[model samples]
Target: MKRILLTGCAGFIGSNFVKTIASEQTDYEFDIIDALTYAGRKETIQEELNKHSFLQFHHLDIRDSSKIEKLFQERKYEGVIHFAAESHVDNSIKNPNIFVETNVLGTLNLLNASLKLFKENEAFRFVHVSTDEVYGQLTDDEPAFTEENQIKPSSPYSASKASSDLLVQSYYETFGLPTMITRCSNNYGPYQFPEKLIPVMIFKAQAKEKLPVYGDGKNIRDWIYVDDHNKGVWDVFLKGLAGEVYNLGGDSERRNIEVVNIILEHLGRSKELISYVTDRPGHDWRYAMDFSKARKELGWSPTVKFEEGIKKTIDWYLENKTWIEMVKGNNK
Candidate 1:
């Protein structure tokens, strides 16, 4: 049985990944470590807790180097799938130091522990989950960011993630650690924190409040379903070559205004609800990924279309009002 340690297992993407693996791999053992930070919630995994024997959860911060070291010493984890970080761009803008500390130092702590533990086992792989924002904005004329794109992160959050990616690469180059990195586009689906674009818009519309659209809402983002993004990460984790980077996108590019309009239409809300506000500092104009590598090598393709996925996501949030309420309560 493969014993895998998944960090940030309570956040949106991480939790989705855990659920997917739990359903698919009955014999696989998973040990989840999450700090239950403002973004991490136990309720994310509560549904499968009673049902999955192969899964275990631990409430711990990745920054606790000693605890991380101890866990590594005790557990025989075959692989480490890292997802923990301060991920929100707005929050990162408000407090960049936390982003640097968590995204860079936290990742380093995990890398250090993994390297030390896997010294005797060179075949162990480390999958670092990252974002396409590291590539910064793409010009209207420029094509999507491929794996070969140079790093040019603009926001503090993206910079921190880029820093972590560099550390991952250093581990691979300096120590020959088996590592793979996946940079994926914006993900939207169930259990997402309301601070994010899709959920925030949905909630504001439901409350009959102004849906804040940053700037003119012309910024473009390739929207990939959370589950599809998770599958792309797993594809890179299991079959990808060490020291390589892969880009994963749903190939569905939508302007921010377009997304807001779609949500409004789906919920039977009016476009007048959209309030165009000042854009955040250093907001990227666009982010699109060229995911041909993952598709060709791992045979992974996004199955859900943008319209269908967004509607399903809206329905989920509507049905699971308790979860949304609980998450909102935590921010207080």
Candidate 2:
């Protein structure tokens, strides 16, 4: 069996990936590692953990180099799909050091370990998951950010991700290590942490609490479902050319206000609950993705539209209040 390592998988998109994609790969054995931070909750995947014979969970902080190396030596992983990071821009603003330590240094450790394995196996692959924010904000008239866009990150989170992306590329160029980077737009789906925009709106709107809208709420984001993004990631891992970068987009661009309004309308909440809050520093005005390369190269495009995906997401959060409470309680 082919053994693979998936880092930071107890969180949102990674958890969904484990549930849907990894579970379907019966020939592949997966070793999932997560720091189990406030956002990464093991409970989200407790059902799969109980029944999936091909899956293993490791309570690991990728920042610990020695421990990471030891695990790498033990597992002798043939592939790595790195999803670990301090992803929340707000949290990154509060403390940038952790983002650097975890996103940059932690990825560096993984690259070092994977290099040894790649040399031994000659077929090892390292796929780094990244965000479109690294390309910075886009204007209304500008063409969507493509794989060819230059890096110009505004927030600390995106900056750290860009740093990791560059480091991965350097390894491939210098050491001939097999690596691919997949940059995707915003993701929304079930099991998303309440701190994110979609979940935040859903939770607050249900409670009749004030819905915080940053700035004038016109900032736009291309919203890909987590499933679509993960599928594109898997395609890149399996079929994409080494040293290549791919962009995955949902093809659904919605303004921040539109997203909030959708949730409010769905929940039958009044617009009076909407509260305009001070925007965070370095908040990118807009983000759009042109994923033509991924489509042409891997035959991958998003299957879930925003409107349909949002309804499914909302229904899930409402149906799984127990899971929600469990995840929220851990953050305290």
- What is the C-alpha local distance difference test score of each model? 0.90, 0.95
Tens digits of per-residue lDDT for model 2 on 60-172?
99999999999999999999999999899999999999999999999999999999899899989999999999999998779999888899999999999999999999999
For candidate 1, give the lDDT.
0.90
Clashes (candidate 1): 0
C-alpha lDDT of residue 181 in model 1 = 96
The numbered model that scores best in lDDT is: 2
lDDT of 1 by residue, 76-110 (tens): 78789999999999998889999988899999998
lDDT of 1 at 89: 94
Candidate 1, which ten residues in sequence have the lowest lDDT sum?
Answer: 19-28
- What TM-score should be assigned to candidate 1? 0.98
RMSD to true structure for each model, in Å: 1.2, 1.0
